[model samples]
Target: MGKLYVVGIGPGGLQHMTVRARQVIEESEVIVGYTKYIDFIAPLIENKEVFSTGMMKEEERCREALRLSKDKIVSIISTGDAGIYGMAGLVLELIENEQVEIVPGVTASSAAASILGAPIMHDSCNISLSDLMTPYELIKKRVEAAAQADFVITLYNPKSKGRPHYLKENIETIKKYRNGNTPVAVVKNALREGQEYEIFTLDSFDDSNVDMLSVVLIGNSQSFVKNGVFITPRGYKL
Candidate 1:
């Protein structure tokens, strides 16, 4: 029987890959992931075999990995922390007597939050606004609930060409539960060179300016702007 490792390589590039993840990927005979995500790590595993899927079809990818584990050592890769809407959720279903291991990495939200300042320093709940599978109403409810609960909100899947108005929907949902002046930080590909971050007051967000590649953080009532960075304190006072 072969062992399976589900690894989170963090967001973008080889530099972000953890020491543990690199160790496992090097040992695995087969590395599997969604294609673009696979490309991001291709250079790291040139000597090993790779299997990737184009887009969607995540369940199919997981099943294939399950099959591969029956025959060879396999690493199923995900970007960012595996537990956060990443490959870990899918692979958890396929675990057998064969050992399945989850290796953690820095998720983009934490990376982005660090770049912008300390917005999630206190209490926060991360929510993805993509309604691809979940109902728009449910997504809306979660957004509203997150905002109302006064939790620092880190929203993923804010915008995409096919579903272009999620950012607007997110802004609308926050408006329902928070004041228009609630501070927000919009980060584009955080940690990558030339990364962009903007501090916006909730009342003035321009929907067309946001995209799916970005991560949006809406601060709680206590969230503040410090030296131009948006921050939600984790309640640890000095």
Candidate 2:
């Protein structure tokens, strides 16, 4: 049996992609992933065979990747960290004694956090507002709990064309526990083309500007902004 490698290519930039991830793609005969993700690494996989699927075809793509791994080394590509919300979990379920390697990459949260200065230097939790596989009510509960615990919250899949109000609802939920003036940041297409980032207060957040590609960071009570930087203090004596 040939080997299967699930690689995270990081957030749509060659510079941000981990070296090991690039190495695996170079070694593999076939690369499989969503169309946009595959295109992001097109420079590296020039001669390799690529099997790409459109959006919402994750399961199909994973199954095809597993099938291709039977005789030749195959790499399944994911944007950001594969283990976070990538193909690692789905591929793992189909692994049966196959030589498997999970190559991690920088996730969107870390990339966005860096761009936003240092808002996650303290305790934080990441949540996705996408209701594709998860129920909306369950997501709301999770947001409520995170807000109540006063954790720095990073929201992935904040908005989509069909679910524009999800982010608004999450903001409302978190506002219950935190002050309306708490700092919130929305980062779109982070570290990639058409990247945009903006900081606002919980009471002033604009939901219309967000989409599926955005990541929203909601700071805890201790977080603050200074000189155009959003920061969460790590409590060091300064």
Candidate 3:
């Protein structure tokens, strides 16, 4: 039977592509992904076809890959670790994903944390600010809960064109349970060059500083930055 590889391309750059992801991409005869993600891997394919599209087309994209995988080797690309808001879920939902192997990559959250010096050493919660799919009220509830639960929170897809107001709303929700002085860090384009990281108190976040490519980590009560590094104490090491 033909095989499929659900490869996470990490962020936007080729260098972030893991060795295994590269190997699988090199072996695949077809690559399927959103247009930008396809561009990230386009150089790796040797005359292989690429199928690309816009948002909310996950099922369509996965179906195309699944059909091709029935006869030829194929890989579906994602921007971050496949399990976290990546193609792994959509592909599995569309087909018997047992036919595919998932190749993990450096996730934005992990990369962001590494650059900021580990705000996630302790358990944290990740919430996407995009409420186009999930209800805004639900998003607010979850953010409030995370804040009340005293967990660090990493916000993904925090702002975009159509959903511009949600980031502020999310922050407001966090305020309901967290101090205005709570620690927050933003890491943009981590690991792939043009990377920018900022560590500051929650009260000072400039909304313009964040984008779709960024991961924003808000620390719990114990997180701190030292020697120019942001850290959340894990209580295990150092």
**Backbone clashes, each candidate:** 5, 0, 1
Once superposed on the true structure, which residue ranges of model 2 sit more than 4 Å away at CA?
none
User: How well is each residue in 26-115 modelled by candidate 3, as lDDT tens digits?
Assistant: 888888999877876767975988888997888889899999999889999998888888999878877764488999988888878878
Q: What value of lDDT does candidate 3 attain over all alpha carbons? A: 0.84
- List RMSD in Å for every model shown: 1.6, 0.9, 1.8
What would the TM-score be for candidate 3 when compared with the true structure? Answer: 0.93
Give the candidate number with the greatest lDDT. Answer: 2
* lDDT score, candidate 2: 0.92
* Cα misplacement distance, residue 185 of candidate 1 (Å): 1.4
Model 1, total clashes: 5
Superior candidate under lDDT, 1 versus 2: 2
Candidate 2 lDDT by residue in tens digits, 120-177: 9999999988898899999999999999999999999998888888888889989999
Better of 1 and 2 by TM-score: 2
Clash list (residue pairs), candidate 2: none
